[model samples]
Target chain A: MQETRLDTARIRAARQVIDPIFLDTPLYRCEALEPVLGCAVSIKLETANPVRSFKARGTELVASLLAGRAAVCASAGNLGQALAWSGRGRGLDVTVVASRFAPAAKLDRIRALDARLELVDGDFDMARERAAAIARSDGIRLVEDSLDIETCEGAATIGLELVDAAPPFDAVLIALGGGALATGVGHVVKTWAPGVEVICVQPLGAPAMTHSWHQRRVVTTDSTDTIADGVAGRRPIPAVLDDLLVVADDAVLVREESIVAGMRMLLDHAGLVVEPSAALGIAAILEDRDRFADRHVATIVCGGNVDMDAYHRWVGARS
Target chain B: MQETRLDTARIRAARQVIDPIFLDTPLYRCEALEPVLGCAVSIKLETANPVRSFKARGTELVASLLAGRAAVCASAGNLGQALAWSGRGRGLDVTVVASRFAPAAKLDRIRALDARLELVDGDFDMARERAAAIARSDGIRLVEDSLDIETCEGAATIGLELVDAAPPFDAVLIALGGGALATGVGHVVKTWAPGVEVICVQPLGAPAMTHSWHQRRVVTTDSTDTIADGVAGRRPIPAVLDDLLVVADDAVLVREESIVAGMRMLLDHAGLVVEPSAALGIAAILEDRDRFADRHVATIVCGGNVDMDAYHRWVGARS
Candidate 1:
């Protein structure tokens, strides 16, 4: 609604401030997977970092801004872990409010990083409310993932790196959640590579952002059921959606089956153990082969943080 | 053997010639895995590349030298793929001889890279002999993986990058096959970081390299039986062993079960789909926890190229 603070200058500045671990991630063409996916795919892998996700980029910058102050946030899992990890090194106390259904692997990691965790009984929306209330009562900053300008700007560093390094692509498909990654990356790509399409992909089971983007208004879903906990959102952040509407060329929804297949394909062809959220781009390719057929496409494999047991079930279900 | 030529200077020079895709791989301490592995573990991830292995470093450097000349080499899988990839772009004809038992995933990739593939009936030793025959008959240079100074020197770049980038570590355990990775990394680590112990690890099923390093001579086994095809060597290259002996502080053999368990552990904790060879360092730690407990240890995840069916069987067998 107000003047946008997320710009190329801030993202370039964030690159200097973000931890080196989250910067300069692996971006390479997946020749091994091209024949099967029917597209020349270049993966900007965000999984190889310490947090095994791209959240560290934003969280690190956000943590730096909150020098000695306490911060609170709600996450499905990755954001909490990223905040905990970033906060630990800076002596910044962080409390994460998460849905009770959040993966055990992430909860354990959050505690391992010495962060206080509060679990809400209902969905992510409920957890967000709890986090806001905690921040308000305790007089701490509520660092929202997508709503925070610094967080989105920090994430925009990924786009800066991608446009600078990745091979020429016709379109770039990004996994859409609360829109930090999509909006951040979309902003840079649209700004620099205007011709390249910035497509956002969300799981069909949780299509809040996808619906909101198409309608140009905030859309809320009744429930979220996807295994892709990272992108499983019910309530869309209106501010993030406004930004996404401007940068996103198109938004696509993928099936549950396709997500599992995408994960298996990555593990089999590319030797990557991508989580459900990370596989969204690949899932999009699987669902609509004709759209990406023989075209050069780039996608950010944004995370790899799935429980082993859950991973086994997802990959093992089909074959 | 002649005076050694693989050194840090050569490795430093090789870094300039080798493809940037293989240089400066992700080397970070896996905090998530430290609790389970009983040590501060840093993984030099070599899987996130075109060839999906560390072999590209040597192969790219070697390919540059044979600009217009044809070359032949024998490989279990990864070296062939790397050579094929490097050679494809350089217009240099390349031939790879491999055992029929080599993973289909690798064989398919080798062919995809447009290299001539020769399948031998027996083992890696038989493939090596066949490759030698081809080189002699065709009047082409036989590029040996470990014996070649250029190849080993190329691999030594990993050591240079590791020492230059990674945090302080007490020891580094590398997978030992023909000894390119182990000897190359050992040379750099021993030369520059003299205090850091350089250990070589091999599968107990194929202990020729370990035995040869210990005895200070070549040791040939009757057969090699291991799921880690990348490091399943029965014949130890004397030249590589000579170099390995000077740099290696210790040589350890890990059980087959331990190697499988290591792969699973890396998959679960580190979010890596490492092949059996890549897991050797983790396997070594798994076997001798006391040897690495509370110590900072670094290990190169050398490769990740295994058949999906086989990968499923390995990770699925126990769980």
Candidate 2:
């Protein structure tokens, strides 16, 4: 196996630098969910913070390091909001590029956070290209979500906290996006608590990261279609794929129907208004009940920034 | 004012005895809620814990003090779950009495927590009588939710946390139940952060606590009707009423419509699936926006235990 470059020491150091609001989130057994999931389920809730997502942890760390400098990033929603929020009060300047088709709620939030918002005519890929062009032309740094080592290190802090959860989970499930959350968390859990399996979940509509992880190389899809915009990455970052190669034990693609059902399950059982992306972990469990049955399983409810209209359309339909 | 007996020192002391899981809950400003609420709002979330309510703080403290003893209490749902959960590892034996009409979700949760449950044929008052009878006949302790000093003291810990919230709030709002959470939090806030107004909220359908607070005496209503079962007290405890008289600076009663609206607001803007009882504070603000507009205000999102059917009927309807 190739020697892992993701440093446990730096990940540990990132803990102190990450905002306290993102640290020590609720990690407890959801008895209500256990019966439904057919497993002893523990939820690591990352939605209770200001940005309503775990993306802030990495963005905050990355912003802190880039203090007094301007940075640009392309996001469907969450990463942009995190960057704008973390950049505020700090000397750092942030510009977010998003597709015109991005959720209005997310775009409005990004603007409210005082970040520069640039709307592209095309999809997320085009937005990424626009961000890169802006960064080059404006002589500013382009901060890629998972491609940044600091972003991964910041996310690894969650793994540190997860290992300390009582009764100890047999497996940990993470939502796979550009691979920051999954790989970052996977690295720490695999390195420290080797006994616990790190399973990454992706929407079947957008399974580039999962496919790339399995193939042990970079992969791209022609298009993406999913309610879980957070994990709908058509193109997987090669560096993050490398991290997943060593760290992630397995990756699963869940049906779109399962995502909606998972959202309803979380709302009914756990009293959480989670985005579809956050529901992917639960959907993964719902897809393969036998693998997790009777075992203590932990999953990070990673975000809760869903648009109300979409939420009603998706989850309300199930109810 | 009459001499205050809800001890600030005991409330502070109770902090250490309470479960760590119930302490240091998310206390942050929700920006998305600000525009809708017409104010700078900070939500003290008590819903993300094991029991999904602030009830655990008091129950844990009360349970700890009653170590190796048998205790009984009547609850709508949250309190019973708290007691059952808190009394688990301890030598304490817990019994919960409830009206047959109590939400099935709560009943199932209480039963799951290993507490002995007694269902009464009539209302909550009938359940209370049954609990008292059980206590007397079995030689067990009758643990009143707010009447017990430890319960209030445990709840007072939230006030301690609130006073430390950043940018400092102009006023704090709390949902009125048996008066433990409101009076406990009020006593601490009024005593320590006297500049911050302690406002208590009750549903218009069940305004016994509000009426009692305004009238400066105990008051009883023939019936109570509200979706917020946690705060649907028809009769106010005289002792807890006395504490409320001293601690609470103001009390507001909001309509059932407003309570439903508040739940929707929390769900849409704050990304929290709070129950009607927990939404009382938000309802109060919505009813009288002029009183809270532009002011920095704090409200305890005190619980998240709601029947899914009720959630859909109330919040889902608005969407």
Candidate 3:
């Protein structure tokens, strides 16, 4: 089967629009984690953004594209803040529909970004559905995570940066969420650094991508729960699934406890404050350190939008 | 009085030793704060390091310069972890003398950096005295904070980056500790952008630099306390004092409450997790927002090495 490729022209155009507002997050060698893994390891720090997440890149691109249109989206956390901030920059109205489960700090952030907040009933799926309906009714553009090609392209820039900054790695561990980040990053790595393995890591409780990969089709679950709130989801977007299948060499589901451990490792060793989803790749590595031993690896610290309360709980729970 | 000029040749040589190990942190426009400040506000994000602080640069430089020599340093938090990490990288034995007041997580980080940790009996002063004694008695190279010219030059790279990255600003806000960061940054800013204002910000409770500036001489106090632990000191080093006096346009003392507010603001608006010292400049801005309402301004986010427990307490206290 032919691999589905990103529209380079569209990506280039989106890059031009988003370049001014977005940051080119740095890619640096993780000397500390290297010895533990027994391989040369580098980390692409996407947490350095003004919004402290990679969602800034995707949402910035989406917001820029919808310059004249009202922008709407549903997010668990980081995406809402990103969209709200980007929308504020462009002088566009933004409405964020968030699940009740979303952190108070994240909701506060969305409001701080000057976005109209809608607290929806039920989980993320229901919130997203409500957002989509509002967008359709109000003639606003719903910047759905899976449907936005620009979001994926924006994320692909990470792969581009990694390939440009560091030597070829044996594997790239990416946290799988709406699949845009993994699919986009995987596309670039598989295409440009063909020898490098691309591993998509998902939370065990929400293994939509893993299930999709095994079944060779898009999959969705009725119920999903995980500590990695950013990547906790049921549905796999078909467009992203096609790209993930083509580009990803393997998939791993990390335990929640390990994810907490990864977060602790990040804080203690790397001095990084990352959310559970951001630590998913590290969690995967921690699960079977020997498997990644003696192989050059790169893991994306995708976001740092964890709420203070959640962080306190996780730290307390882990300690 | 003449300024203590940075030895550019030495800084250039030091860069060769340190560049590979440390990140060249970004100097970019603070878009969110700029409109409020009414001047072009830029910030140097030195917090995007392994230790999540600018101390990494100085520690790396000092460690590399020490070559095969054993190293010792006294730190509130960031410096110890930085030295530990850099020392480990070079296979040098490192001992960090930290005060009991320092964060537990910071001690963990120092250990994680593979350094020998020594918890001192008292505050940062006692830690410094102990480190100095150890270095002298054991023939280990002491990576003293303000007294070391190399450390200052290493930090001066922040100024160099700022000058190269952004156009000249009217003022630059720096949080002063033992004065290494302020002196280094001030030296470069004054040399490169002569017209730029250099404002030194100190916590009201720990006003070593402020007292020195007022008395027109180095000042010392028996004890000092402030939420901005990174900048909380009772004495100013004479080596940095002369340069600080010559280059620093003025100095401001920020209230503890304002500094806490600044931290929350960064987390809320800028999506940044900054320690109190890093927020001092922003705190100063917020304190007198009308004064800076319309000026081209720049500030350094010196470090991000706050204790989680301390952070929780500070935020809780503020609320």
lDDT score, candidate 3, position B191 = 79
How far is A91's C-alpha from truth in model 1 (Å)?
A: 0.9
**Which pairs clash inside model 1?**
none
Model 1 per-residue lDDT at B215: 86
Q: Which candidate wins on DockQ?
A: 2
DockQ, structure candidate 2: 0.56
- Given candidate 1, what's the lDDT at residue A235? 91
Instruction: Write candidate 1's Cα lDDT for A1-319 as tens digits.
Output: 2234477788888988888988888889899888889889999999998889999999998899897889999988999999999999887899999988988988889989999999999888889999999999999999898999877887888888778764678989999999999999999988888888899999999999999999999989899989999988899988898899888899999999999999988887898988899999999999999999989999899999888788877887322
- Which prediction has more favorable TM-score, 1 or 3? 1
Cα deviation of B196, candidate 2, in Å: 0.9
> Ranking under DockQ, best-scoring first?
2, 1, 3
Q: Calculate DockQ per candidate and list them.
A: 0.53, 0.56, 0.20
Alpha carbon deviation, residue A254, candidate 2 (Å): 1.5
Candidate with top lDDT is: 1
The list of candidate 1 runs beyond 4 A from truth reads: A1-4, A317-319, B1-3, B317-319
Q: How do the residues A78-111 of candidate 2 rate in per-residue lDDT, one tens digit apiece?
A: 8999999999857789999998988787888999
Q: Which is the better candidate, 2 or 3, if ranked by TM-score?
A: 2
Writing each residue's lDDT as its tens digit, candidate 3 over A106-197 gives: 78778867899998877788888999999999988888885688778878878777776555788999999888888888888877788888
Cα lDDT tens digits, model 2, B31-80, are 89888889988899999988999999989888888888899999988889
